[model samples]
Target: MASFEVIGGRKLSGEITPQGAKNEALQVICAVLLTEEPVTITNIPDIVDVQKLIQLLSEMGVTVTREDEETYTFEARNINLEYLESKQFVNLGRAIRGSVMIMGPMLARFGMCKLPKPGGDKIGRRRMDTHFIGLEKLGAKFKYDSSDEFFHINANGRLKGTYMLLDEASVTGTANIVMGAVMAEGLTTIYNAACEPYVQQLCRMLNRMGAKISGIGSNLLTIEGVEKLGGTTHKLLPDMIEIGSFIGMAAMTGSEITIKNCQIQELGLIPDTFRQLGIKMEFRGDDIYIPTQENYTIETYIDGSILTIADQIWPGFTPDLLSIALVVATQAKGTVLIHQKMFESRLFFVDKLIDMGAQIILCDPHRATVIGHNKQVSLRGIRMTSPDIRAGVALLIAALSADGKSVIDNVEQIDRGYQKIDQRLNALGAQITRI
Candidate 1:
């Protein structure tokens, strides 16, 4: 029940180090169930979701040790499959959608996994059908109890891999199936898979655990089943979503900030998407340097065309970032159409922007037309509560650029991803405080 109070119109000028990727950390933690040896993970973000996952793992009898503040050593040698039936497991499952990933490793290792409906951002209808279908294709039987809101999966025999064409490029779906296929009995070919950096990191971690996986950075992946996997130490890549958020925050507040230790290579097509809004960034080694500027303009296509920023599967712009991009567009000069194709209700938060004097046309559920301020008008400060992870960060960016003090409630939603966001912003000279 924390909230952020921000005094706006402050030029942020300092260096900020981005935290480890939340999405990748979740998958890597779940990969611990693939081995009995201790898997030491460094640079782990101390976020609410990771804490919840650790609690869930401990409830399942995994030896989760906190070596220090930002390091954790997990050994799932004597994991009790029965723990999944415990109320602690069920409650933690409802806190993070990533909890569903445990089902794959548990079923592969222990032959059974009972999990409740996973909880995450209520953006839209996020179906687990893709995950269940993918695992079912790999010789797992699934049972659901509507009244109890739990899924029972059993795979007594060795999983037999098969070809799977995902209905959609669901990120968690791809991660779940990847974990299941690694310990299967045959070759697993996944087409139209999610190839985001986080997913790729999971594939790499599995490979480190002796799993044979090809097409690491492509939508089509081939995973050769292995008999066993061993523990390996893996470091998480920097969160590109946080990097994108910093880019938007710096631009909206006309701040000069350097984001350090960013995995620039993994930020594919993200920089280009931000460039459409005329947010210029310089890459020096592992750092992205954003210089202070006045009057940023939105870049359009040739022949006076309107620029459309949309999200697709891998190699395409990510839907998770579209919310931040939309807020950045509001501060730029000119207009652009922000299209969120994957989730229907994601753009519903733009009405709050319209209330702040930004020109935005909500074109149905999937699209919004944002007429940039051209540096002509500033968004007035408003009190709001965060709706989801991405939208919460978007509101933070808007609050940083507004005319007066703004209060953003429900900051727990933002904590699910970004770690120590207020401190990081404060390091960048942002007038943000958690109250």
Candidate 2:
């Protein structure tokens, strides 16, 4: 239902603006159904899976116009497509795993799309078989009813692009096969593609509405088959896993925080994986700052070994921020090992950080280890619950570096992806109440 409580050893400071980019606004709000002209988008991250895919594109009519709380203006001219063979878009498209990327722009503009069975963040077997094997290798035709689970898909006439190769590298299956190879008709070579900046800002908003992609940020994508696709404004790109969970909640509450407008070079390798758990980042121009330190040590591997951190694919190191780098390596100073090679249950929430005293070691469903305790025994708060969405904001950054109160029941799985996250960590002072 609703719970947060928090309170812990607080220390927070100021600047915090990293919203907009819930996985690139669900692949740029399904690239506004591949354009019917009028796609305004902006720093949109009023989360809940991007407002349930903009309320399922206004229940499939698409014209969503807001322009304020983080802007919007979609306008898929007049789409209803029988509400994608409704049961109410299959119960609002099974609560968003990016609503299966609206079957790649509704099978590239209404060649039939009807999906269901989608939902997100169980953190495990998330496989729409590479989004229907790259939209059935761009010719589309993937049935799977199961008496009404639904995933029908079709491409009745025009959809010809070719060359695929993607077995993995599926950021929403290469953004639903680059929104069905940008209105497929000709060239489309996607090979192992998933160059995420949310698929390079959905290939630069489908090349400013006129698709022709071309190896953006690498992994080889090259769309170029446009017959239609118009409106464009796009702007999202800040949430590098909520700026690596506010640089791991300002190094597990030593807090000096300064995040603000953080586009700091698309945060590759997430500030060197939290400086290999030593914290202290500084970028300034486009802000990252994060200072307030005391200890933070953990760096090893030049041969010394014992320093794992893992999670590759996209300048590597973002398996949704390795659960805020394993809760900022449990107050770093020593061990590391996160691993989490593409989810198994997202390290089973580190047994609620080893029941709140923190010394982790699950080392199973995709590795864990942690073991820092450098704050030397502070974490004490308990009653946790949140299961998914990056381990519920990594158990709300280990309940804001625990020490006292810490309720956190579900919290709607961190508000389906943090946006008003306890009112922006209560303006950087953070007590987080949201009950």
Candidate 3:
């Protein structure tokens, strides 16, 4: 288990560019399996989860060439479908939730695929029903092996297009269904689809590769099944989660930092959500410049009530950043409620922050009330363990702004999502040592 040894109370400055979106990279990289042609992708984040997915694909016999650190060309001309039955495949597939995505493309093209119960952050119960159900609507059959916890999915000939109103607008579920529907025989309409930038990028990339998809940025997507898809080059957007984390770090530590090339428009409600926490930021071109602030006050609702920031679908506050908001609010001037609707266990990390002297009330499994100290009191760092990726970075931010040293164990959780996080923050003057 890797750990981060951080000395807090040091203000950092300088510019840091966000990595290519991890969420987007996972989706599009799996889309390569839908075609035999070479799919070149740039801006892939060099991280553990992404690497695990790429290695999984390679073991499945997808020819992967690394053009650069962030660019890869994947040719799925001769995928080894037999590998799916191997115990080795199960070990690799169980390491990342993104491994579930390969099912759609593999089944769409090769007509069969198997997956072990996928693994990711233990935030809460992440259901795979949405993925399986949506694909079932497109004429796929699924069977579960209770003994091995593997899903066996097979398409009945070529998938026939149909309409599906998703139970939820799950990003991965929607991406999976879209990939499965792209090569079906007729028109497929997906209502209540995820319209996040990552999903939109996947749809656009499919279009570029000869698939016909409409509704590039809306919940209602229509896909006219093409006979086949071809090769295309795609670039991933900057990770909004990382960008939000950087914003929180800047405010918490009273530092001035510029986040460059942030693809500001695609960030949706992220900026305003942070603004609601009283963190001030300026948009200089495509860069976000956060100035040093000794104090920033949380905003009240329109009726002068305490502010409540809840996570919702796209165009709403992202559930992923609620931890960052909670951490940033620790030093803000007013009170706020963070409702983490998507994951029940995400707020459990607050007990660690409370140990460091932040006043936070864990209302329940999904909500917390934070009483900001307004920087009148600095958090005293202590030893802690990272429970998940977002919570890990949130703890790191808290440690950075604390008065003393802190040790964060299981930092591999953070590295799964954030690429070279300690090194990147260190370049901007943070004292984070990997031990």
Candidate 4:
């Protein structure tokens, strides 16, 4: 385990660039298996999760070439089916949640695939029923191995596409089904599909490779099956979650920071959601500028009631940023309820903030009440342990603005999602040492 010792109360003034979106990179890297030709992707984030996925590809026999620090070409001409059944595959797949998506391309191209129970942050009951149900609707058979705890999916022949109404708008589930449906035998209509920018980018990249997908940014998606897909170039958008984290970081620390090349168009409703939390931002030529501020006030409804910040599916405030919002609200000038409806355990990290002298009420597993300090007093730092990727970054932000030395353990969780986070923040005048 790695830990970060942070000396707080430093005013960081500079510019920072958001890394390539991690979720988008996860989806696109798996799509490379949909074709034998070389697929090149640029602006890939060098985070642990992405690197693990790349390693999984190499283990499965994809020819991965590093073109540069931020670019890679992947060619899956000869996939090792034998490796798919080995313990190495199961161990590798069990290390990350995104590995479950391999079933889609595997069934699309090879008509069969198997995977062990994938692992990820235990934020909530992230059900795989949606993935299995959607894939089964596409004419695939599923079998579970009790001893091995592995899932086996097979199609007698090429999959026959059809209509599927997902029980929930699952992002990874939608991506998996879309990849499988692209090379199926007929047309596929997916209602109640996830229309997140990550999903839209996946569809666009597939379309660039000859997949026919309609309704790129809508909930209802229609995909016409094709015989094959060709390789093409794709660039990932800047990470919106990271951008949101930076916004929260700047606000909490009273730092004047510029976030560069943030694909402002793809980020729908995120800026406004932060604005509701009283973060003032400027749109400066594709960048987001946040000047230093002594205080910011939370906005209330027209009825003059306490504001409620909640997370929903895409086109709504993302659940990933709810933790960030909760942290930012701790320093604002009003009271707001942070509702994390999607994940039950995500709000539990607020207890640690309470130990650091924050005014937070853990109402329940899914909701928290934060009473802002109003910049009259600063937060006192303490030692803490990070629980997950998003929560770890929130704690890091809290530590940056705290009044004393703070040590964060389990920082590997932070590294899994963020690309060189300590170095990036250090460049902005933050004192963080990794040990």
The C-alpha stretches of model 2 lying farther than 4 A from their native spots are 1-3, 7-47, 61-78, 81-107, 110-173, 195-302, 305-311, 314-317, 326-328, 331-371, 379-392, 395-397, 406-413, 418-434
lDDT for model 1: 0.89
Q: Candidate 4 at residue 236, lDDT?
A: 97
lDDT of 4 by residue, 1-435 (tens): 899999999999999999999999999999999999999999999999999999999999999999999999999999999998898998999999999989899999999999999998979889898889988999899999999999989988899889989999999999999999999999999999999999999999999999999999999999999999999999999999999999999999999999999999989889999999899999998999999989999999999999998998989999999999999998999999999999999999998899988999999999999999997878888999999999999999999999999999999999999999999999999999998
Candidate 1: 10-residue stretch with minimal lDDT: 81-90
Considering lDDT, where higher is better, how would the candidates rank from best to worst? 3, 4, 1, 2
Could you give candidate 2's per-residue lDDT for residues 1-435 as a string of tens digits?
889899889899988788888888888888888777888888898878889889988989998989898998988888978878777788888988788888888888877787889888787887679888788878889889899888788999777899989889878888888888888999989988888777888888888888888889898888878889898898888788888888888888998978888877887878887887888888889988988997889899999888988899988887888888888888887988888887788788788788888888786899878888889888888888888878888888888889899898988988988877888788778888887
Residue pair clashes in candidate 2: none
Q: Work out the TM-score per prediction.
A: 0.98, 0.36, 0.99, 0.99
User: What is candidate 1's CA lDDT for residue 225?
Assistant: 94
Provide the overall lDDT of each model, using Cα atoms, as 2-decimal numbers: 0.89, 0.84, 0.95, 0.95
- State in Å the error of residue 36, model 1: 0.7
| 1 against 3, candidate with superior TM-score | 3
Indicate the TM-score of model 4.
Answer: 0.99
lDDT of 1 by residue, 1-435 (tens): 999999999999978888888888988899899889889998898888988998889888899889988889999999887677788878889988889889788877776788899999899988889989999999999999999999989997888889989998888889999999999998999999999989988998889889999999888999999989998888899888899999988999998999998889998999888888999899999999999978788988898899999998778888889999999999899999999998899998898888877889998899999999876889999899899999999999999999998999999999988888998788777888899
Question: At residue 323, what lDDT does model 2 achieve?
Answer: 83
CA error at residue 263 for candidate 2, angstroms: 34
